[model samples]
Target: MLGILGLDELTERVYRELIHLGPSSVEALALRLSLDRDRVHRSVQMLEAKALASRNAVGQVQTAPPQLALGALLTAQRHALGQAELTAAALAEAYHSASTRSMHDLVEVAVGADQVRQRFEHIQLSAETELLALVQSTPEVVEPGQSFAEEEAVRRGVHYRVVIERPMLEEPGAMESVLGEVLGPERIRVVESVSTRVLIADRGTVMLPLTESPQVAEREGRRLDEVGEPMALVSRAPGLVTAMLGLFEYVWQRAVPVRLADDGLDAASADSAPTTLDLRILSLLLVGSTDAAIAKQLGLGLRTVQRRVAHMMELAGVTTRLQLGWQAHERGWLS
Candidate 1:
């Protein structure tokens, strides 16, 4: 029974013999059992480590005789182990809760950068449907391991969309190559603003750099790496995801659409850049503004706000209102 329970066979044998043979010195125990003195001493050491035996003043080992108290000691050990397990579980829950809380709720020192990256990676691998990203750095700076495995994942029907800043497209390296290869002019959208790094997966999870301008290219590669357990929270609350999606749409509507016209379109005000009216509509929506309020603020019909929001969702490739919010925030659509 002890063997089945993971006890070493030799330890079990030694323990049983000690129980049956009465308290004896190591030499006596070894001679009686026909085992090496060194082996007997080592087994005695193991028993001492577990508090199952003791050593006398002369450095001789003594096994505790089995008694009613032995059962109590075993029970105490089981209880202590149970308490340790529970404490560990509780701490894990607390850490996850702290990680998900907003910046307002964060009182502790900033977590290590590696910890944040690992958490983000966990979100990426577990994505079920779509991955909406607002990239602050080049793709090469994010996920350098753009291996065939990732290509295989996309081949298997993953919806991968990225809203990149203008500076990255104009610059060189993996960012330029990735944009040309994966996004291209037709597939990409440009948000012309200083961006915070954001990675959202399947609408269920999100990862972002806690810093205003994360040195993502210098520190972490393409993707925000994941930390801790796979399912653990990598950033602020899930509610923030809604805010970010709305913000992405807000930006997408105003952002200059990238086209495949052979010549890149020049960014100019004459091109009907987003005006103050667009900004007002975004502000209203971010504050949970109803269609009527948005229209009143922007001097448009209630139907207009609805139509624009719908169009924004289409541009961002999201379905529901909440997803739109997440997309918006991810793309720096809002302030």
Candidate 2:
């Protein structure tokens, strides 16, 4: 029972025997436990160190009163724990400094969904400035309540920017749920497709799946299977992180922004703009289709599609195509 205070089994046994026998000699304890005298002597020394036993002037070992002895042991244990906590704090600081110096060796390979999720939560909690994520598909291994960490991070002022694929928004109330959980719609963007799943923090650390071929992953943006064990790569390499930042920025520019109704519009007000044809164009834009692709899908000329898009942008009072999409959604044109 007192082993937590550094008492070995033999010491505890001898101490109990001494307490029971009442002021016993080492030989007597050895005989009672069927242990050798030398072993019993060693246990006495350990018990003395723990303040559980003491020696009189005649060199006879005596067990201290259990009340006093146990109390002293508990106090010593508390003091030791306090010191250990201080030492741990100092060690953590040193480790952080060393990790910063060893960025090249920071790349790690984690196997299975649990490990990937754990790494993601750690990165989010450690983020100081901003977080950028390209979510192509949801992993099936999400632990219950794990999303609370992300919500807390956002509340603490970590600038979060997530680009989600269009297909994920097809689920009923999906957009509403995301907007409610995150700070607002401005933090999210939608793309027709995402090439890969990525999470980058502070432009210093990057993480992505390792099981898929990079080229195929980028080209197809396939969903990860729920039953499959996924592997991920985490890195803090400066050059690699820089390249990832560039990729995120490129996608961010082309992606359509999501504007929430709460930003300033009632349901009726939002449903007041854009004709059916303009709504069709906005739908294609939401899925990340190009002007030519939009024209081909709607059986219209490329120039005609471009002209309509430009007119919508003018009506929405936005300069960029992506911003136009945001306004269309804001006005409930694509709702």
Error of 1 at 279 (Å): 28
The superposed Cα distance between candidate 1 and the true structure at residue 251, in angstroms, equals 1.6
Q: lDDT tens string, model 2, 1-335?
A: 86898888999899888888888788888988999999999999998988789987777799889998898879888999999999999999999989866854778887886797788888889988898988774443442224666777887888988877776555434545544546542267778777788889988999988765333444576653522566888998888899899989999878776544333332123333555565655765777667777676556688878877777787889999879867876776644
- Each model's C-alpha lDDT? 0.58, 0.74
Which residue runs does candidate 2 get wrong by more than 4 Å? 1-105, 138-140, 143-146, 212-228, 261-264, 270-285, 288-335
Q: Write the per-residue lDDT of candidate 1 for residues 161-205, one digit (tens) a residue.
A: 666665544322323354544433124455655355566677755
Best by lDDT: 2
Best-fitting candidate, scored by TM-score = 2
- Estimate the overall C-alpha local distance difference test score of candidate 1: 0.58
38 in model 1: Cα distance from truth in Å? 77
RMSD of each: 18.6, 16.8
Misplaced by over 4 Å in model 1 are 1-114, 138-152, 172-176, 183-186, 212-236, 260-335
The estimated TM-scores of all candidates read 0.37, 0.48
